[model samples]
Target: MTDVVSEPTTVTGVDTPPASPARGRWDADEHGWFGDFGGRWIPEALVAALEELTVAWKDAMADESFLAELDAVGREYAGLPSPLYEAKALSEKAGVRVLLKREDLLHTGAHKIRNVLGQALLTKRMGKKRVIAETGAGQHGVASATAAAFFGLDCTVYMGAVDTRRQALNVARMRLLGAEVIPVESGSATLKDAINEAMRDWVASVDETAYLFGTAAGPHPFPSLVQSFTRGIGDEARAQCLERYGRLPDAVAACVGGGSNAIGLFTAFLDDPDVAVWGFEAGGDGVDTDRHAATIVGGGAGVLHGSRTMILADSDGQTVESHSVSAGLDYPGVGPQHAHLAATGRASYEAVTDTEAMDALALLARTEGIIPAIESAHAIAGALRIGPRLAAEHGPDALLLVNLSGRGDKDMVTATRWFGLDPETATTDPVGDPDSDPRA
Candidate 1:
């Protein structure tokens, strides 16, 4: 962050070479469209605020002081430049050297902190005394709350009632961090609904409140803005890979919920054609079933949450309810950039079943002694699924860096039920057994 990376400028009309093919067409055009995906689609009243946010973000990106401040907060407060860990046992299973970007080890136990802190700084720059966001899995809500606490800003988070129940620990954690967590019960009682509620609140309070978007999926500036904050994941990973492996990774894998983490990693390597990029979506029961959050795989191009992108929708254009056991990935729409990537073949998108993600989660915990968020487990599962192919393409020493977006402590309850583990069931070993039944 010492030197900020500016967004790609639209070189249309009299464009000479189209912004160098190697650097990727990631910059939003003058209209803010990423290959016809991103745009500003909110009410007229919010236009001034959105434009103001965009200008502030662009100014901040161009400012050295802002970049240095962000870097300082990331390293000193968020424990950033999180290490790249080589998972030996996992590599054995995948037939490649599987490297994991250890964002799970970050200060808030998640990569969400990076973007939250950046946006929080923007809030201060805007002279806002309050911040707001909507979260599905609670990782973002927790991050927003933590940043608000640090800046002494009043924070409000909107979460679906269902997420409130599923991610109860995160709810408690957010409350403890001094955030007002409101549970939205409208619509499917999930993330999309919570987003609706949050937007409504933002429209009413934009003058004094900054809606710190949780993902890269929202309107124009957000997709680019969030990616700007998170590209550090790929920035650090790419450097570490070169230093460790003497070259770029053969592939990079990251889970796609609203597509922030995947875009974060993919941006660094988009210019490297040799390094394959994979984005895994939550398959829920399976993509073949009615339940899944496989936006790119099973969805069509549409607008949702203000941006034109691939979305889970019916024939009438109503957003369908997406299902994923991992609360983090249960979204109907993805970031516009991801849609563009999949459409243009810059990146591959696939779905991993809930069972597969869970298995991968357990495998990583047992092998690397690192428990990963179920959202990240989708990426782990994806690497396991595609590693052999990469080896065939790149050789036995093929490398893939998986973005471990967050720690699994927030998902223990779901894991306990999934694996039928009884907390009361004592094991002869210190590590409790997942198969042991307390009733026995």
Candidate 2:
């Protein structure tokens, strides 16, 4: 791995600017390379736009007024500093203390709002009147639309046709927010396809529109920018943990799709060697099978969606379609920074199967009365799976922090199909007797 610079220079069209103050240990270097993983890989037409964005990002980060505006908007509108709740019942069940970083309570019911608001503000700063985005499970799309409406920017979201059907509620929500929703039917008709379409639109409309890339996986400035906006998750959780429990968590866990939430939660803890960072990928069925989105666990290093990262690809290095019960976790590639972290042994990643994740969703709902998004369920499942080992190693005092990245309201359709909650389609009573005791 390349040694990271304390203060790295920023990249312009061809020249390099002087070193700017570092945002964090994991911030990418000049040219946007995160170690060997991230760098701009795109058509020549998009280079100017990326260069513009890179400069804007560096300037915004250095601007006190911009920082204050973002913070004020976050606290006043998006619900900043979300609560850290100790899941007593879950802790008892897992044999280790479990603390949940409740990002699900944020506006639009997901952590995607943080990045959206930041990029939306950036769009305004750049004097852009329109914003475009791509989404998988639709949380990011909804968040983007919400931000655009709030900021009075024209919003357009490209979503997978499959996702539009599965996550219909969120698609509707986005439309109701006055954003135009376009369903991409090409490729796997999923996140990857949506991104391709969005990128195509961005290349054509670079001057008047800003592409609000959903996750931290995209090229260059996006990975760093998304991390900067969402790292508040870790910053808040770290302080909350210190204040509430007097120490950092023994382990920090989050589900990794394109890796924004995991990176967000892992950022503040990366320098703390004693704290283990764990990322759970979506294992649709299982990793042993071909149907899974477990990029780090099952994939090799390759470029996908403009960044060199671990990807689900076939023998000829072609991208494979990834499957997952949760739409948000259905992706073939991960963020370049996650690739760097795993490569350097600063973090560990594992695949959580669909069955395991659903079981965890049910467990959390019954135990804590909190129905987490399926993406977040993967983290909960991973925490449960590793809890015993943590307990054995650290005794009963082992504490695990799991990022609840989103609420499950948008996932009811998928969860209903998975859990057989609908009587019309019921083959078996998945929830047990309706007449029985509610807690039983």
Candidate 3:
């Protein structure tokens, strides 16, 4: 990065601009930033709703009373300022300095809670009585349910039948939180189907309900809204990294499941050209195989569920199935901002295989005593693959921060069975069919 003198600025509350164009694109009047590919591409019916949401969010951002209430809830109820843990043990094992942003410690055990809370607050202010959302790993479902219970609102979570079957515990948790969990059996019976169902509900009940989208994808305000709500992760991580280390980390990494967590951590560091941003997408069997969810790495432009983003679509533009070890990372599309970031060379996207992510899961558990969600394991996988490359190319002193997006408590049973581990006994490697082991 080239250094230059600052310029005089006249805007009352705005800071002076950097000497160079922002590494990521920004709209001063719109108050939205893009990497070059993000914009609203949706049906006409959603335009009004999205514009309303944008206006409401801007108002909330400016409302001191709303900010005070949100701040109090975040601190006293949702546990803000989650720890930026120094992963000394894992760092030693990886041969790189690694830090983990413990978003898992937040209420409902994932970063999804942050967006849900902010959106739910807006829902309340909008005088909506019902909140609807879609979930994959059930993280967002659980988070929405938690928020609904906290604010005394009706919550409905649409999940695919496959997800409900795979994440039974999360289903029960949502029920316990007083939410109605409806399983969508149409289409592939996965996240996409659930999203379609939620959109239908939203379109029908736009007057009485608010749809709290789970990730930084979907229509207009969602990518921007979720990013704003999740920016705290990066904000805290940036400050903590500076305080702990003498400077910013060489790179920040996270898994890109609809790209919420990635965008969250990436936004704060976007202006810093020296720091690299990496997003790991799930490579289920392998990127070479037919069954992977690496949309950014292996997909093409197409519209899906109201957004014009890169999706796993066939040549005819039909949506295709996606596979991943973690349900959360199995979506066929990613947030448009991520697509833009990739297009502009502002960020890099990599695919992490199921075997690789599972290996990362075990490595983090044994080496750091912290079991991360499969979604987060993708970041660990990225660290393993990218850490050595960066160290060899840059230097050994290069710093790496992996967003440990969520804990793995919800995945124990599934992981155990998938790895063929005896529930009663300790295990190291995950279970796989010997005949199905592609590496073998």
Candidate 4:
């Protein structure tokens, strides 16, 4: 166990796509997860307003008209409820059962679509003509832009200069979707800076713009909002698991960047208690070093991004540099609900190192033929640890569910180069950081 932050707390192979193709129907009335978790913990100026918006969201989920509109948009435009697939080879290899909630197969190749779709629908209802968001990995930006295009709304995405260069293809994707991407060059020129710039923009233009955030952190309504849209993951997994295994999985696992995917999958099992839940954090090198975003394991309670949560910070409350192989999980703070769950000891948190995640990535590629995003590979790595434990402690037939948040297509350049495989030269084991900006 490590200090500073505080103490806290599977495998398969398959030729699964980055995300599953949208399928199945969603029960809109199952908003209990969002109702209990998402709430406004912001400035008084935004509190009552957020409350009203929550009321509308609740009403919308219940309104057959609103459900029909969302369903229509999902099918013809947004593509809702991506598939859940069983990782047969990988599960057999792991000596335990494993299933994947394929969010990567969405239109944008990530779970970001679930959130953006919900936010976009809410924006239209609020009569907002413009939407602004902040992104670290660019998945959110692409998803937001996709939603904006579908809704005919103007979208602006704030990204760190560093991330823009590292994820250049995503920048192009956002632009192609007709969203203006602003690269922030201030501060560390990474995620935190982009977030700061987005806050400034939101404060200045709060009247006609809705800030569609990317994760389950931030203030109230956001954790709730994003979760509402994302619960489709768990809902699908439950039925799929039952269909495949004849019972619920013994455990559910997902990578926790801002805790969106993990929360989405874990929400349904919160009351079950018997269905164990695990959230994996980025252990860049190791939690022993200051080179990870394992907030609940290596950080402390603090206010960040408009909410009280565990944040990686220095003694003076200034955020510290967080390092992780996955750009998506390299943030210093996490969602408030994760912080709450970690505190209450209802769930467990652990760290997955860069090497472990990479190994998991390779194993999946070779065994199941599915290439996972590096961020999600962390969860796969953690599942490897869980699978063996459950197989031994429970039974040889213990079932495990892993949320594959996104695909590896966006990360191939980095992954190939990180593992010393040169895509251009067709040489395996190439070296050096793949994120070096060609024009920098």
Candidate 5:
């Protein structure tokens, strides 16, 4: 069961995970099983390739030169050690000393690049000349294309037809990065569809291509590998918290879709007995309405996208379509590590409605002058819901670190539609005067 900070109960009650060295351990078994959540469930055609990747990954883990190269690339190119900014205005509103790990400032935007650069480096080690990936919101695709361009490797990104139309700016960004963008028309024409198409490509091109998984929900090595690279988000925040606040935070929150960002932050605080980790999921209409992506709350255990974890699936084990205003958080399943963390009570998972996320997006924009990507807004929503509660429970000094995962420039159109602001006049309008706006 998880510890409860008595207040408004923004997060549900669960038994706290026990304090043990192994309770929140990271590495999976050789087969990549994370307590039955991760393992290669791919067809026979890709097994050998995966095994080779597993071995090379192990070697890369021990190679000091490889690590130094990765660190150099992260700092000099992709922008590691992203600032931990005090959200003073939002903090005052929330009644907690809130800090944001600003991943939004990193090159190519968002936390996706942390894993992309690492995987691209590994691609060279594997002697692969081509890299392929799937994207929903297109941030990952842009990051992947940037990495491939840097490495001079051929890159292809599969995106849903619907997503390309919605997130077209990112589509153009990916194209400009010289990556081929393939629009998938199957199924719901979203992330899962893109994944299906990418998997087919991998099956046929395994020898020359590495399937660079976009998030942390895939088979074993990917879940672990992506987290290993992006854990820098948490690592930097952990140190920065100590330097700035002189103590660990009461809680850390991040939005969970396929859960790369959340896992990146959570893995850093797993062993800290006092630091609680929380994950907020997308609640489209609301989790109770069955139109949401609150997988941990409304879903059952099932296999999806090559991993066995919490999933939004029907009785026959077919994955359900998830909806959210935030395309990035609209997945049917979460990473295996998140499932284990939730099951063991190492963390609590909550849902924020689309309205709540949009409200938080606007709140941060007005109060802090930062427009969070809609996916990151879920974390902002959690802060708003949990901050006052923490103050009530832990007093005024309650500190919280939120992963500010991406900037919201990509969501201006969505924000414009959600808040009903005229794009032509909204930029010059005063910040807090939503009443002066046409929507009011």
Candidate 6:
């Protein structure tokens, strides 16, 4: 990869706090460097586009009319302020107080809708007629297509061929929403490859097309931009905890692929020294194995997908393919801001194996009747493993907030196969005993 290195510079108005708690030392600098990570590392062809987007985003954030419109659209169309629920059954089983930020209940059934809606609105403000995006598990693709249709903008999404098959339902959903779905067959045929194709398209069509990056990774403005849009996940959860339970959660957790949802939920609690932040990365088998996507836990610093961050790279600095059962978490690199967070000891990250995540998924489905996306299941698994220890130290009152990043409707195929469910009969006695009390 071509590395773009630059000296750090001071950020001015860009550091303005959102509606949530002040970021304090967590804000990115002027050139978008969040400590040693985050910067515009791309071919010279895309520099102008990034610069333009940076200015446009800053301007839009300053405009009250634009802000109001984004808020209105989010509430009326994309479902903002998703409710927070105490997962009583889950808490009882885990031996800790578990509260779920129900992003899965949002309009598009994921936190991705928030970012897409904001970017789509910005696209319109920039007079772009079309938008292009890259997706892994397809939540972002579905959200982008939904936003494009709502805004009367043409949309095209690039997805990995492997993911296209695994997430075929989402591909159909995107097509139904009027998006052109392109299956990328290059380089491991995963999220990174899709991003490569999207960046190429963006470079060629910079004038009339805006690249609505799905994650809080990529170059300068994107990481910051995506965070600004999705930070509501944490902001709302923080307030909900205060109003409902009379205090903030003792700890917060989310899955980290490209780190958007994790960053979104972590932003509001970053300044709260008492609240511990945790990120769970996909561990296909284990971090000790070659097959995994635990970037923060297993990778080193390198440039990938336009930002210098923690990535799975070889001794020669070549990109290494990452693996995970959940397509959303099968990425080799993480968001630059996440790298900074990990480096500064602001957040702790761990790897959750596929078996662990799948078990957590089943547990949630059985106990709480909530089937979370496999990506989110990683967070659940991590929380379950750590919850009891935390409870031991802090007593039963220790509260853990988990971001249910997406629903599992799109993952039924994978789930069915994993659990060996009878697809023909649509019933199985695999997980629990059928002879026992049905509800028990």
TM-score of each: 0.91, 0.93, 0.90, 0.86, 0.92, 0.93
lDDT, model 2, position 8: 18
Error of 6 at 411 (Å): 0.4
Better of 3 and 4 by TM-score: 3
Runs in model 1 deviating more than 4 A are 1-24, 424-440
Displacement of the residue 293 alpha carbon in candidate 2, Å = 0.2
lDDT for every model?
0.87, 0.89, 0.83, 0.78, 0.86, 0.89
**Residue pairs in collision within model 5:** 1-14, 1-15, 1-16, 2-14, 2-15, 2-16
Candidate 4 lDDT, 335-421, residue by residue in tens? 877776776666789999999898888777776778999999999999888888889977868888899999999888878777767
Q: RMSD for all candidates, in order, please.
A: 6.6, 6.2, 5.2, 7.9, 5.5, 5.9
| Residue 359, candidate 5: alpha-carbon lDDT | 81
Minimal lDDT window, size 10, model 1: 11-20
Which ten contiguous residues of candidate 4 have the minimum total lDDT? 20-29
lDDT of 5: 0.86
Selected candidate, larger lDDT, 2 vs 3: 2
Error of 6 at 56 (Å): 0.7
* Candidate with more favorable, higher TM-score: 1 or 6: 6
For model 2, the local distance difference test gives 0.89
lDDT of 1 by residue, 1-440 (tens): 12224533221233122112323456677567888788987788888888999899988888999999999999999998999999888888888889999999998898999999999999999899999999998889999999999989999999999889988888999999999999999998889999999999999999999999999988878998898888889988877777666677778999999988888888887766666789999999998998999999999999898899999999999999999989999999999999988887878999999999998888788777888999999999999999999888877788889999999998898887787666576345423444322222
Candidate 2 TM-score, true structure as reference:
0.93
Better of 3 and 6 by TM-score: 6
Could you tell me the lDDT of residue 142 within candidate 2? 92
Off by over 4 Å in 6: 1-23, 423-428, 432-439
**Candidate closer to the true structure by lDDT (higher is better), 2 or 5:** 2
- C-alpha lDDT of candidate 1 relative to the true structure: 0.87
Q: What ranges in model 4 sit over 4 Å off?
A: 1-52, 76-79, 423-440
